[model samples]
Target: MNDPIVKVEKLSHRYSVQWAIRDIDFEITKNGIYGLLGSNGAGKSTTMNIMCGVLKQTAGNVFIRGINIRDNPVEAKRHIGFLPQKPPLHVDLTVEEYLRYCARLRHIPKQEIEKAITDVMGRCAITHFRKRLIRNLSGGYQQRVGIAQAIIHNPEFVVLDEPTNGLDPNQILEIRKLVKEIAEERTIILSTHILSEVQATCDHIRMIEQGRVVFAGTVDEFDNYIIPNTLIVTMISMPPADELRSIPGIAGVEELGGPKYRLKFTDGQDVKERIIETSVARGWRLTEIFAEKSSLDAIFAELSKK
Candidate 1:
């Protein structure tokens, strides 16, 4: 495999007495979307800042395309594009103007700045709003403009910090589509608190909690961290809680009000069939019987506890 587009090793950052991030290590491969998930104040912003050269790391190193950011800030940064939670839009300027400014700042050749701006505007789906002042455009359009600026120079890596924050459902979907479209040939690190966004857009995920990486792997790997080989059986006519607990291979049962029970099974047990058979034998109606797969929410809650 090719070397990672972005490499972080033992990265640490602190704010005075409080440690915002501690000894985190991860890599962003080429041409894939990586989700950085965490709850509020989970040091996600701090980590992104350090990786993008916006903040100094207390320890560890950040390399962009094999170039250490600290050793060669300019060259390393040329390969990266960043859009913060709040886009740094000049509300007074038109979308085209703003993108032109970004192209110049990124050191695109003077002759190619116009063409670069045009291309990024189209790519980000802001071509229709190119002449509109950012202040006058809708929230979704503003976000498109922000992304346009981020990719104006065609960087190999794009980092977006909560790009969908503060948008309506429609706008969120639009932005999600835009992120996916842009990720076809570039590495994208999407940092957001919305787990659903990660589920929808990311190929792999790294879950951060209170300044540490608690989970890192594909979505399937994260889901596997939750209870394994467990099934949830809901019945409308469940026996008395204690009687339900007596079934074979039944390790435990949680009563969830009015004939509803969650049954846990022992390893290598076909508890579902037994529950169905017992219900049928007793002439009790089984309202719902199905296997339950672990959701990302359950996995995140479990990891956050650590």
Candidate 2:
């Protein structure tokens, strides 16, 4: 098995009298997108900052490609590209100029600087804006420029904090596609509060709360953690709640709206056929009746309880 491209163990960070993050741990394998999910002020940024060597951790260690960041900061950093919550952009420079500068800063060979800039710009789909001043571009285009700088070095690992924070639906889709394409060869760690973003883009998810990882696994694992034996059933025809409750295997039911209900069931039972039979016996007009797995939003809410 290939070693993890990024490993963070027992990581902790403090701010004067406060602990921003505590004992966080996770790993990222090559060529996969890992989602870091948490609410605001949940230490998502602090953890990302520490991983990129932008902020010092009060305790613990971060390793990139088997190199300890604390012992060899420069070498460790050379293998990482980080985009913070607010992307750092030089508004005065055009996209091409800024990227060329980044390539130089990343120490790409002088002879390869131009080619690196051109390649990354094209990879991020910002080639059209190469000659445009960054300040003059739309937020989406500016974001693409940020991405271009992050990947210009062809780092083995990329850490992006809220990459799709402020974009319309179309722009969000475009950036998501860009991140997916980039993950083909490099490890991408994405941190976001947007549950849909994880569901749409991540192969695995790690959910943190109060500076500690509460859950870490694939999307299916996260969903199962919160909703082990649950199903949502919606019907266009209104049925009496009490009568619906009489079904044998149903453990509980909650009315969601005028004609919707969320049903919980005991383990080792399939309730769909029973629900159908009940509807038929009562002569109820059942427009729709199907079981649904809980969504990521539901899972997050369930996991973040007091």
Candidate 3:
């Protein structure tokens, strides 16, 4: 059987008198983008630093493809790539020069270094800026270069901390596209507090709040964490509030003043189907009916409380 790509067990960290993260755990077993979601200072960076072997944990262990990171960091790190919050960039050097230097740091042989640099630059869409000094590149291109450095070694797992923290909206979209492309062949850990980042880029999420794993699951699961209790229905000919409440699944009816009504339902109720069927039978003329989904911001706030 193949080993899981990454496994974090009972991870904890502390700074002097305060604990930053405690008893956190999760696993990655495939090649896709997984988000390490949390607010600022919510221990996202601390956790990624430990997983990539940049910082030692106060307790627990991290494994990369079944190899213990602390016991054999070199071997474990060979399978891992990391781009911290502030990218480790040398702004004075040209893009190609910087990538070449990174390739050397990863210990690629001299014979294959050029091909490695060329391939990575192409993949990152920065081939045109090869000779451009890093400092001259825009924030978006610089971010692309940062991503390029992280994956220069083609590691199986990559950790990216807030890769889009300061870029404008267009740049954020570009970086997100780039990250998705990179994940097609390798597993990526996208650590960020941005709700949309996770919704748009991640296949799975592990949300942290106040130094703990408040929620962990697929994006759909996270979004549906709180089952919607109300649904909105609009009709050309609306029924009386008490008449609508007489339906089997509906617990209460709230008249929304116009042709709209709000329905409250108990758990395990098929309210929509019942409402539609009743509307048709009673000739109420149902025009629109759909459940109102909880917003990501609401879910984030809710999870943080736990």
How many residue pairs clash per model?
A: 0, 0, 0
Best by TM-score: 3
lDDT against the true structure, per candidate, is 0.86, 0.86, 0.91
Worst 10-residue lDDT window, candidate 1:
227-236
Candidate 3 matches the true fold with a TM-score of 0.94
Pairs clashing within candidate 2: none
Distance (Å) between predicted and true CA of 198, model 1?
1.6
Write down the TM-score of every candidate: 0.88, 0.87, 0.94
C-alpha positional error of residue 67 in candidate 1 after TM-score superposition, expressed in Å: 0.5
Model 2: residue 257 alpha-carbon error in angstroms: 9.0
In the predicted model 3, the residue pairs found to clash are: none
Over the full model, what C-alpha lDDT does candidate 1 score relative to the true structure? 0.86
User: Which one is best on lDDT?
Assistant: 3
The TM-score that candidate 1 achieves is: 0.88
Clashes of 1: 0
Better of 2 and 3 by lDDT: 3
RMSD to true structure for each model, in Å? 2.8, 2.9, 1.8
Flag regions of model 1 displaced more than 4 Å. Answer: 228-230, 234-244, 253-261, 268-289
Please give, for residues 1-306, the per-residue lDDT of candidate 2 as tens digits: 365798899999899989988998887765799999999998899998888988889999999998899889889989999888788999999998899888888989999998898899889888888898999998888888888889899999999999999999999999999999999988999999999999899989888888899889998788676545655666766777787778878888889887778777774355777887887788766667655666677788777764
